[model samples]
Target: MSATAPTETQDLAPVRTESLAELLIATERPPRPSALSACLTFGWRAMLKIKHVPEQLFDVTAFPIMMVLMYTYLFGGALAGSPQEYIQYLLPGILVMSVVMITMYTGVSVNTDIEKGVFDRFRTLPIWRPSTMVGYLLGDALRYAIASVVILTVGLIMGFRPDGGLLGVVGGIAVLLVFSFAFSWIWTMFGLLLRTEKSVMGVSMMVIFPLTFLSDIFVKPETMPGWLQAFVNNNPITHVSSAVRALMDGTSPTTELMWTLGWVVLLVGVFGPVTMRLYNRK
Candidate 1:
């Protein structure tokens, strides 16, 4: 009888199911990160993006300087009789405008990450759910602080003085940051809801321009028409700007600050859950 050739299966070793199980069990799974730890980690990741692309800082630095200079000179003589005098009024409001305007980029960043599928990996992770969103805000909070400092520096060079002194300036910036952090939730929600980065930007501009310009950023709300003033008086930007201005002027901004904090609560309350829902679904 002719010897039969050994089949491929006959040469193979028996499968080691027990060995595989033992190997997997050998290494203990790492514990899950706390919410704060996860958020801080993602926040650091955002900072790393800035480190890789230093140009990311242009909005906070160069744009703020330009705003301080342009508005100080352009409307200074006409509005306040001189650039120096106008900077006194314009700096605080402009700081608010610059920072708030830049908050849109948070949404842009979120959208870009989504488009590139970065968030898909994030979603697969076992960390806290809202950490990613909170991380974006925390990173952008640094941008907001930088913008505030840049604007303040430019204003100082241009003869803008804060009557509130160091304490006042610090308080003003602190309040601005709080409001900005809260305000950013709106954009985060938009970022999750919108399909494209450009769409997110367009909608943000539409909403921000009306809120920033129609309020007291550039001109006194009282100068506007009665109907417009009605809206401006109620605008959240108005409260924030007024609060900052009052703080810098070394006065108690109780009413404005209360209104601003209320808006902060209202904004986060309304948009925070909606954003999380979208993030989960997305």
Candidate 2:
């Protein structure tokens, strides 16, 4: 009988099996740690920029300090009790405002990246897909944290004391930072959607100005007319400001924190997806 035809494997006998080392080397790369690594790298870069520039820290730190002193020394008696008492009352609100202002840096940063074509380069890199947007937000959170600390330190120097103790102060700052992160997402969307940094600042000012004025920032919401009062009462900033005040005053848990967090969840849920979408388009 004729010998059976060689099997397919025998026909391909010249092929060499890969060594374990080669196999491991050629193995598919591990899944991208897009969010984590990107956040870390981008955040580290932000810190580095802050360290190098030094001047950028001025807006976040000095501006808030000046605002506190101006309000306390100039308008303190007109608005409330003595400057010391006003400092006590206003520091928390000012801190919240400081964090809110700090969030604008997110847009400024994005604009800078766009101008420098940094984001374009990012597209060429095999980075974690989620890192682009997550990295930005993470970087901003770090910046905001630093600004908040500096602002709080200045407030302390100016005789503003938080009666809630060290833990309370920590919690107060934490609350404001979380609120700022949530707020930053909204601005991030605006920044991404806009073509210029100045436009981002202008539009943001228009959007936030009314909200800030109507909230309990410079005055008690209850002191306003009914319509304004209703709006102020419903504003998320009002709740955040009130919650921060309560925390600074060493008061018990209030509905304001709960409300503020609820809004934070809602905004993050909405804008988190928006950021991902816009980031992908870029």
The lDDT values for all models are 0.93, 0.80
Model 2 global lDDT (CA atoms, 0 to 1)? 0.80
Worst 10 residues of 2 by lDDT: 9-18
Model 1: per-residue lDDT, tens digit, 4-85?
A: 9987655667769998798879677889999999999999998899999999999999998988888888899999898888
| TM-score of each candidate structure, all chains considered together | 0.93, 0.85
On a 0 to 1 TM-score scale, where does candidate 2 land against the true structure? 0.85
Query: Taking the tens digit of each residue's C-alpha lDDT, what string does model 2 give over 1-282?
Result: 899987665454454456646865865777765557777897778778878998878887778778778878886788786787778888888778777866877876887787789988887877776566656777777767777787788888978878898888888888887888788888778778889999989988887778777788888876788989989999988888899888878997569989999999999999878976887897
Query: Which residue runs of candidate 2 sit more than 4 Å off their true CA positions?
Result: 1-31
Candidate 1 off by > 4 Å: 1-15
> By lDDT, who's the top model here?
1
Model 1 is weakest, by summed lDDT over 10 consecutive residues, at: 6-15
On a 0 to 100 scale, what is the lDDT of residue 38 in model 2? 72
What lDDT would candidate 1 get against the real structure? 0.93
